[model samples]
Each structure stands twice: as C-alpha cells, then as structure tokens.
Target: MIHQVQRSTQVGRTTHSPKRRVTPIYAPGRRHPVGQVVGDAFIKHIAFSKHTLRSPRAIAFDVSTLDDAERAGAVVAEIHDTESRNVWTAPIALIRSKGFPVRRGFGNQWALTLEHWSRNGLQSEAEAREEQQAAKQAAASVVQLGLFGGGL
Candidate 1:
C-alpha cells in the first residue's frame, strides 16, 4: 500500500505538505534565573571594554524594549576630540543579570534603568581617609586592661 501511494504521488496531482515552523524556547521573564553565566557574559562583552571600564568624558545608554520584555541595550561613549562616539552592546540575557535591580513596568514587564557611569578603580582619597578613620576607631575600642588586672 505504501509503495502504491508513492507511485501514485509521483504520477500527478499530489497535495504538498505545509512546512512546519519552529518556535524557540526562551526563559520566562517573571521567573527567569540570572546567574554567573549571565554576569560573565555581560562582563566579557560590555564591562571588559576599555571604553566602558575607563572613565570617559561622558557615557550614555540606549535601551530598546521588546514585546516579550526583552531589551536591546547599548552603551555610547564620548571621548574627547573623537569625531564619533563608541558604542558598546551586550546580550539581553547578560544585561538581565541577577546582580542588577529590575522593576516591573506598566505592563508588568521587567526593566532595568541606568543611572550613572563611573570607572572601576581603587578608593578615592576621601574614601581612603574614611577607611583609615574607621580602622582607628576599631583599634581604639580594644582595651589593654593590663593582663592580671582583668584575667592574668
């Protein structure tokens, strides 16, 4: 019967089968777990760039939101005397790292906002001074008590 059907189909007047479309599986936004993988990807692509890690004259970001609450993010950097700005981008999955704070939007979509950009570096003078003060305070709190006077 199968051979007969094959022959008949070859002869004439056969209906063509529709092509099956494949949909991709994506992590659910509401419960998606962002972990080290996401953070690593973000750091490798975005944070590791000298243009991003170093202090630029100015920095800006453009975020385009999608229907699925996915976003396309880009960092724009303006360097002194540069004719064009440098643009850095990272995967949406990476940008949605667990470390970042996200909020629910009007449509119950998750969104992250960029507030400021700064270089990653050691502590500033003021911060160092404050740290030294804290250390001194901690040391002062330790009492000598003169051994035998308290416990020998």
Candidate 2:
C-alpha cells in the first residue's frame, strides 16, 4: 500500500520598472534621409572642392543626426600641400552616401574644371579679349560669302 501526499511551495512576485520610450532623433525629407544628412553635406563639400579648383588640406565632418548606438559614421580627411596646409570642416549627411555615384560624377567634373584652370593659369581679362578676337578671326576666315551674299 502507498500513501500519496501533496506539497505546495510559495513563490514571491517581482515587479519590473516600466520601459522607457525613445523618441526618434531625425525626420525624413524628400532629398535628405532621416539620419544621413551629414554624409550628404560632407560629400558635397568634396564635390565642391573637385569642381571649384579649391584644394583643402583637411576636412572635418559632423554627424549628429546619424549618431546612434548601432552605427555612427564620420568623415575626416587631410590633404597635404608642399607649400602650406589648410583645414576645412563640415557635416556629413546620409543623402550623400546613398547618392555616391552622382556625387562622385560631379566631383570628377569638378576635378576636370580645376585641372583646366591650373593648366591654363586662368585667362586674364586682356587674355580673354585676345582669345575672343582670335576666335572671331578664325570663324571669319572659315566662312566665305557667295555671289548672292549668302554665307557658304
């Protein structure tokens, strides 16, 4: 013969603190992303340098909007010059990272512009007048007037 017994154990109840609500840091825009605005600005600065015939020694970027626990991107570049050095700082927006191709292409075009300026040393007012006169003369020589007074 076996006897059956029932046993009960008391358990304590634990209360947890309420969860804190987190608010979003950034809002979305048509051209700008919620957090990538800084990146865009930084890239734009780079592109500007490329096109504007400007050489900056250093560039510092601010990325406050995109600063998150998971990821925070930043940009800091230094360009060394033999004679002297200069520093430039700007914020990096998210839009620039996403639109890298467009930014890069624009930068390339800017670089070409700078190169042309560097090579030609930028024509002076007098030099421009001379060039215009030469171009006009060349055009005039290429075109001939026919008997009916029509350009051929």
Candidate 3:
C-alpha cells in the first residue's frame, strides 16, 4: 500500500512522498544479550541521505525519555559523540555479532539509513561499503526522479 500525501515542490511540481521504513530502536538484548563493551569505540558518522550529509558535524543530545519508549516496543541508547561532544539516540538495534544502527533522521529511505546505522559501530569496512551503497542509491533515485519528472 502506498501512502499518498501530496506536497508542492519549489517548482510547484507535485510528488508522492518517499517510502518510509519505521525501524525499531536498537536495544542491546532482544535477539541476543548485550556483550561487554570492549572499549570506547571510534566509529565514523556515516550516511547518504536525501539532505546533504551536513557538516557531518556533531552536537550534544539528551535521551532521558527512552525508558518510557520501551512500552511502545522499542529501545534506544544515548551515545555521546566524543568528537563533537554530542549525544544522540536512535531506535536501532546493537545486536551481538552485528553492527549498530543509528539513523540521523535525514530521510525516509530505509536503505540509506540502514547502511549508516549498521556501519556506525561495526567493522571498519562497513562504513565504506554502506557509504558506497547509499551514494549509489541516492544517485539512482536522483536519476529516476529526473527521468520521471520527480513524481515517484
């Protein structure tokens, strides 16, 4: 099923809303329990979103309400970005033997968000792979939009 919410573009062109995937928060112990944190991890903030990956800068955040979110069937982690001293929270899972996913709320593109989230704290190669994939997808979408007159 397609959700049809229409909005006017800058050029007054009508376009259907992009497909959105609402992902649950990243809890440590759903499929598997949280493993002992090895150490302070230095992971890259990676994403290829609709909006320019702005400054790729960081800022502080307060995730004081996630406990209440559990009742809604999701979990979150408040992580501080040491580089920018920013704290961020997201509804992504950090499963054992898996990568952590923290969406920057950039777009509704699930694939775009997935690569970054999965690569955020996983293997180093994850960043490169996800970034490449997201860039390709974003480029493809742009071409599609251009070809289709920006409706799809």
Comparing 2 and 3 on TM-score, the stronger one: 3
lDDT of 2 by residue, 1-152 (tens): 11112333234563544333222223222233222212212112224343233342222222333233113223422222223333222222322332122233322211111111111134434446778999998777656444447766
**Considering lDDT, where higher is better, how would the candidates rank from best to worst?**
3, 2, 1
lDDT per residue (tens digit) for residues 96-152 in model 1: 441133232323233222222212333334446778999987665554434336423
Clashing pairs in 1: none
TM-score for every candidate vs. truth?
0.21, 0.18, 0.23
Q: Give candidate 1 misplaced runs (Cα > 4 Å).
A: 1-41, 44-101, 104-118, 124-130, 142-152
Top candidate on TM-score is: 3
Runs in model 3 with CA error above 4 Å? 1-95, 99-123
Off by over 4 Å in 2: 1-110, 118-121, 124-138, 146-152
- Residue 76 of model 2 has an lDDT of 20
lDDT of 2 at 133: 100
> What is residue 7's positional error in candidate 3, in angstroms?
59
Error of 2 at 17 (Å): 64
Ranking by TM-score: 3, 1, 2
How far residue 102's Cα lies from its native spot in candidate 2, in Å, is: 8.8
The CA lDDT of each predicted structure is 0.29, 0.30, 0.34
